[model samples]
Target: MAQAHHMRIGEVAERTGLSLRTIRYYGEVDLVVPSARSRGGYRLYTETDVDRLQLIKRMKPLGFSLDETRELLAAVDGLSADDTDEDERAALAERLDSFEAAIADRCVTLRRQLEMAEEFAERLRRRRAGRAASA
Candidate 1:
């Protein structure tokens, strides 16, 4: 069997685009605990751990709270487990569906906000151009 690759905290941060402090806080919050420790007691992470951090980073822009991110991660983990029974899998699927719906709604709202901001910026540009023309 191939051995799993491991990385230290700094590499994980660079790969996941998360700050060192944020990664440590996620560990403290039980969001993405390291997969192992080095002989010197430094935190060691696997590729899977980096993936989880990336997921959390994506959730941040969508206004997901820590609790919500945790819940979603739980559902995803449950679904991915090999020993999950049919009934449990169904429940986890339902939870994932709800999260998907919420994400879609948030995306729509974000698009609307982006459109408004763009419109405002265009208006400002037009005003500036008018002033330049008059001068």
Candidate 2:
């Protein structure tokens, strides 16, 4: 694939399916910042930035906080091809497992919240019927 290309912020947004505002927000949060800027002050993104954006997009739906996302990106940054050490690869794998666990916990929390909302609605319906019968 062609890795010798750059894109402006607009094109990055289009390719990533993220809004311009969201891309800017990610930059502000230090989740996915532009690699460089054009002479005209436009944000320039490289292939690495595209990959980071993809990671961020995937993590967001899993309810990852910006801080957690930042840490994950830092972990990604720490990987090196020169480091053929087993310990280093094992450490990275452990961190990824932790991230996955966090996402799973968030999914459980969301399911609980949904269940609570449903129960609350049913209680509200019961109260409404009780009031209607007395009226």
- Per TM-score, the best of the predicted structures is 1
Tell me the whole-model lDDT of each prediction, alpha carbons only: 0.97, 0.86
**What does candidate 1's lDDT look like per residue over 1-135, in tens digits?**
998899999999999889999999999999999999999999999989999999999999999999999999999999999999999999999999999999999999999999999999999999999999999
Q: For model 2, how does the per-residue alpha-carbon lDDT over 22-70 read when each residue is reduced to its tens digit?
A: 9999999888878888799998999888888989998888777888899
Best candidate (score: lDDT): 1
Give each prediction's root-mean-square deviation over alpha carbons: 0.6, 3.6
After superposition, candidate 1 runs with Cα above 4 Å error: none
Q: What are the clashing pairs of model 1?
A: none
Estimate the TM-score of every prediction.
0.98, 0.68
Q: Candidate 2 at residue 4, lDDT?
A: 59
Lowest-sum lDDT 10-residue window in model 2 = 75-84
